[model samples]
Target chain A: MNDPGRRLPSGSEPVPDPADGPTDGPAGGLTGARSSDRTRAAILRAARAHFARHGYERTTIRAVAADAAIDASMVMRYFGSKENLFDAALTIDLRLPDLAAVARDDLPRVLVRHFLDRWEGDPADDALLLLLRSAVTHERAAERMREIFAEQVAPALGEAVDPRRAGLVSAQLLGLALTRYLLRAPGVTALTPDEVTELYAPALAAVLS
Target chain B: MNDPGRRLPSGSEPVPDPADGPTDGPAGGLTGARSSDRTRAAILRAARAHFARHGYERTTIRAVAADAAIDASMVMRYFGSKENLFDAALTIDLRLPDLAAVARDDLPRVLVRHFLDRWEGDPADDALLLLLRSAVTHERAAERMREIFAEQVAPALGEAVDPRRAGLVSAQLLGLALTRYLLRAPGVTALTPDEVTELYAPALAAVLS
Candidate 1:
C-alpha cells in the first residue's frame, strides 16, 4: 500500500524537465536524442503523479498530458496507452546501499532506516508507491513490482546473506508500508522513525543474518 | 496475493444448493426464515467464488446469481448492488486461539504455526484472502481488512505481547501472506509450514515477550 501524499527520494531519477524545449542545446540537431529523453522523463514524472493520486482505473492520458504540459496526442505517441504509461512510470531504483560496505552489526539499522526515509519523505512523486498501490489489482503491475525486488533487492542482498532471504526482506518492509502508511494501523503508525528503526531493524536483521 | 487454483478450507460455508427449492423445507411456511438464511448463504458462497475467480470488478451480480442457480432479479433484491455483495462477501472470523491458556515458551510456535496453518490449509473459502486481494483498490475493503486485524489479531496477540506489537504482528504475517501466496515470492513459498515456524517464530517471539 502507498500514500499519495508521500514522495520518491529526490534526485532518484533524472529531474524531469519543466519545459519541453531544447533551449540548452545549441543548433538542437545533435541534442535531439537527449531532448527526446527529457520529454519522456517529464511524461513519466507526470504519469507517476497522476497514478499516485488516482490509481490505475482513474488516471487518464489526458490528465497526464495536462500535468506534463504536453498534448494528449504526444502522450499516446510516447506510451501507446494508459497501460504502457503506467508500466513505464513504475520503473524505480531503490538505491540500496552496498551491504558489503556497511559494518555487519550496522547492516540492520541501515536497511531499516533506508526504507523509512524513502517512504516517509516529502510529497512530490513516488513510482514505487504507485506500483504498490496499483499492483493489487493489475497482474502486470504486480509482476513488475516483483521484478524490481528480485532484480534490485535479491542481488543486493546476495552480497551479505542468502539471496533467497531477499524476498522475505521485501515482504517485511512492504508489509510495514502496508500497515503504517496504507492501512494506517494505530500501532506502528504512531512510532517515530527512530522508534521504527529500533523495533524493526532486529526483525529485518534476523532475515539478513 | 492469492492463487486462483487454491481453495478456501472445505466446509467453511454451507455448500451451495445445486437446486434452489423448498424441497427440503416442510410445508415452506414454518421454514421461511430458515429458507431465507439458506438462500443468503448460497448467494454468498457463489459471490465468494465469483469474486475469487474474477475479482471485484469483473464479477457481476448476474454471474453470481447464475452460479448460485438463482435469478438475477433475486440477486439484486438480496444484495442491492455488486458493491454491497462484495462487502457482505468479505465477512470472516479468524477463529483465533485463546493465547492466555498457552504456555510462554510455546507461544511463538503457536502463533507462527497458527497463521501458517490458516494460510496454507487446503482451499475452500478464505474471506481474509479475498479481502487482501480487493483491499488494494477499494477504500472500504481496506478499512474492513484493518478492522479484521484489529479485532481478531490485536487482541489475540495482546494476551502475550505488550498489546502494542499486535499491529506489527499483523503486518508481519500479512506481509508474509503477500509474498508467499499472492506474490509467490521464491523464499517463503519454498519453506514448509514447519520451516516457517522454526524461522519466523523466534522473530515473532521477540515481539511477544
Candidate 2:
C-alpha cells in the first residue's frame, strides 16, 4: 500500500465535500490535485528510465527516487518494492494496428513501419524497448515479453498465419529492436529508420505471407 | 599475457626434442601429453559454460576452476587473467558453408540448418551464445559481438545482398538466437530444430535474395 496520508487525507475536515472533486472544485483545489498526479507521473517516468538503462537486478528504488528528485521512501510508499515498481514501470501498450483490415500483401510493411515509428518516435513512450533492454538478462522481463507477444501481437495477426509463423514474425520484429536499439550493433545502428523499414519490410512480408 | 610458467615450461634439458611432439612421440609419452591436453580442454569447456551462464561480469576464474575440478591457480596458469581466458574460450568458427557454391535458392535452408546444427549440436561448442549472454550487459562482450558480426558474418554474406540487408539478415538470425536460446521464450523454444529450419529458411531466403 502507498502512503496512508495520501490515500486518506487526515482529519482536516469534519465531513468530505463533494465539491472537492475536480469537476466541481475551485481552480486552486483542482491545481493541487493535478500537482499530486504530476508527482506520481514523474516517479513512474524515472522508474522506467532506470529500468531501461540498468536491468532489473541492478536498478534500485533509491536510484529511481534520486532520478525523480524525491525521497526513497516516497518511491516505496508509491510502488511498494523494486519488483512491484518494475511491474508498474513496464506498463507497455504495443499499439499494434488492426492488421485484419489491411490488405494481406501490405501487412508486413505496415507492421514494420509501425514498430520503426514506435521505437524512433519518442524514447519516453517506448515501453517495448524498455522491456526488451531488460528481457535479455532478466527472467521477469523475458516472461513479460512473452506475454506481450502472445497477448498483443498474436491476436492481432489472428488466424491469418500459423501460430508458429506468428511467433517467428515476433522474433524478427523483436530482433530488430535487440540489434538496433538495445545492442546498438554497428550495421543495424547505421541505418536510418527509413532504410531499416525499406530493408526489413520485405522480409516481414515473406514471413507474413 | 597469461602465466609465464605455463607459456615457458621449466627445462629438464636445453635441447628441444622433435620426438616429444605428439606426431612422433613414443606411445606412453603421447598418452601423457594427450592427458594434459584433455585437462586444458576441460578447463576451457568449463570456462565457456560459466561465461555463458554468468556473463563477463560475474564469471570468476575460481568458479571456473571449481567447475572443471582443477586448482584455481591452474586456471590462471592456463588462461592468465579472466580477459585472456574469455578470449581463449570464444574461439568460434561459424564454419558457414560456401554460399556461392550452393544453389541460389537453397542458400536459406543451408544457412538456417547450419546455424541450428551448430547451436543444438553441443553446449561446449556454443561460444556465440556465451557472447550473446555477456554482450547485453558487458561493454567488452558487446564490442566483441560487433567484431564477430562485422568480421565473420558480413564477409561471409559478401555482396550476396546489399550490406544493409546483410546486416538485417544477421539481425534476424541473432534475434532468433536471442529469443529461443538466450531468453528461452516458450513459443520459440517449443519448436524443434527442424521446425525452426523449415519456418525460418524462407524468411532468410527473402533477406538473401
Candidate 3:
C-alpha cells in the first residue's frame, strides 16, 4: 500500500502529474495526500466556525489557522487568502427541492418545512447566519442574497406563473426569514412553529394560485 | 439677534453654564439656545446621512461631526455616543395607513402603493437599507430589523386581523419588502407595480380571511 506511483484526489479530475511529480513514486504514493486532505478540511471547518461567530470583517486567517492547528502559511498556500477561504467555505448551493413538483396548495407548508429543516439541520450554516446578520450592514452581503434567491428560488418556480409574480412570491418567502428569523422582531419571534405554518400556508398557496 | 441676554424660544426656561459655578442666569434664559438648537439639528442630519451610507458599525461620530461641520465633542455632547446618535437619528415611528378601512379586494393594491410610498418617501430610512445589506453579519442590526417589524407592522396587522394570526400575516408582508425591495431577488424584482398588487393582495388578504 506504500506504492508512490498512485494519484491523489485534488478535488477534481486527476490530471497526470509530470513524471518527477510524487504520483510515480510507488503504488500508494499518498504520503502527503492524507495530510493535505486533513489540512484542507480543517481550514474549511475553522473558516466556517470563525465566520459564523465573528462575521467577515472580524475573521482572521491566523485565528482560523490556530483553530485548525495549522500554520497561517499553510492556509494561504491552500486557499490563497482569507477572502478566498471565506468564498470557498461559504459557497453553498442551496439545493432546494423541486418547487414545481409540490402541489401548489401545499406550497407554503412545503416551503416552510424546507426552510426550517435547512436551518435546523446544520450548525455549520453559521456562514448563512453571519451573512444574514451582515446583510443589515454590508452591500456585498445583500448582493449575495439577491444572487442566491435569483439563481436558486426563481428557477425552481417554473414557467407557469409570470416571472414578475414569481419573483414577488419568492421575495415574500425569503422575507419571512429575514424579518422573523434573522431580525427576531417581537411578535414574529413569539409565534410557535405550528402557527407560522398554518398562517403562511394558505398565503403561500394563494401566491401561486 | 446675537443678544447674549436673549432667552430661548421657551419664554421661561433657565440657562446655566457649568463653567459659571452652576449659577442660574435667569429663571428663563436663552443664552446660546439658538446655537444649541442648530447644533442638535445639524447632528441629526449628519447622523442620518452617515447611518444611511456606512450603517451603525462603520459610521463614526467623528465622521458625522465632519459631515455636519461641527466638532466631534459637540456630537458627543449632544448625542452622548454613536449608539445614541443612531437612536436619535432613527427615532421614526412608521405611521402606516389604515388597512381595515380599505375594501378587501383592493387590499393588495393599497398595500403595494403604501409600501412603495413609504420606502420612496424618506431617503433617511437608510437604516432599512443597512438592515437589508448587513442583516447577515450583525446581530444588533438584525435585532433592529426585528424590532421595526414587530413594533410597526405587527401592531397594525394584529388590529386589522385575528390577533393570533397576525404574526404570519405580518411575516408575508414584511417578506415582500425583504425579497422585492431589499434583496431584489430576481423574479420578485421584475414584477410591475400593478402585477405585484395582483399577486400579493390575495395572499395578504388570506392571512386575515
Candidate 3, residues B1-209: lDDT per residue as tens digits?
A: 21211111111212222211233345346468655765676667666657666556788989889877889998998989887787666555556777667776676667666775455444334434444454444565556655666677666654655655566665676677666555556566566555677788788777778
TM-score for predicted model 2 compared with the true structure: 0.82
Second chain TM-score for model 1: 0.80
TM-scores of all predicted structures: 0.83, 0.82, 0.75
What tens digits encode model 2's per-residue C-alpha lDDT throughout B1-209? 21101211121222222112223445466576665665677677677777766666788999889877889999898778999999877666676777778787887788878877667653433466677766766667777777777887888776757777777888898888877876676667778878888888888888777
Mind giving the per-residue lDDT tens digits that candidate 1 earns over B1-209?
Answer: 43422554233445643223332555556576767867887887788767865677788898888877899999888889998889888877666789878888887789878777666662323565677777765678888987888788877765547545777777778787777767666666777777677777766665555
Give the winner by DockQ.
1
Model 2 agreement with the true structure over A1-209: per-residue lDDT tens digits: 21111211111222222112223345465676665555566676677766766666787989878877889998898788999988866767778888899888888888988987667653434356567766766778878888888898888998868778888888899888777765677778778777777778888877766
Instruction: Name model 2 segments beyond 4 Å from true.
Output: A1-36, B1-37
Candidate number 3, chain A TM-score:
0.72
- How many pairs in model 3 have backbone atoms within 3 A of each other, for residues 3 or more apart or on separate chains, i.e. clashes? 41
Which stretch of 10 consecutive residues in model 3 chain A shows the poorest summed lDDT?
Answer: A2-11
What's the CA RMSD for each of the models? Answer: 5.3, 11.1, 12.1
Task: Give the C-alpha lDDT of model 1.
Answer: 0.71
Could you arrange the candidates by DockQ from highest to lowest?
Answer: 1, 2, 3
Report fnat for all candidates as fractions from 0 to 1.
0.48, 0.59, 0.79
Q: Give candidate 3's error at residue B191 in angstroms.
A: 3.2
Rank by TM-score, highest first.
1, 2, 3
- In model 1, state the lDDT of residue B139: 77
lDDT of 1 by residue, A26-109 (tens): 545647687777778778877886786677777889988987778999999999998888878777777788877888788778
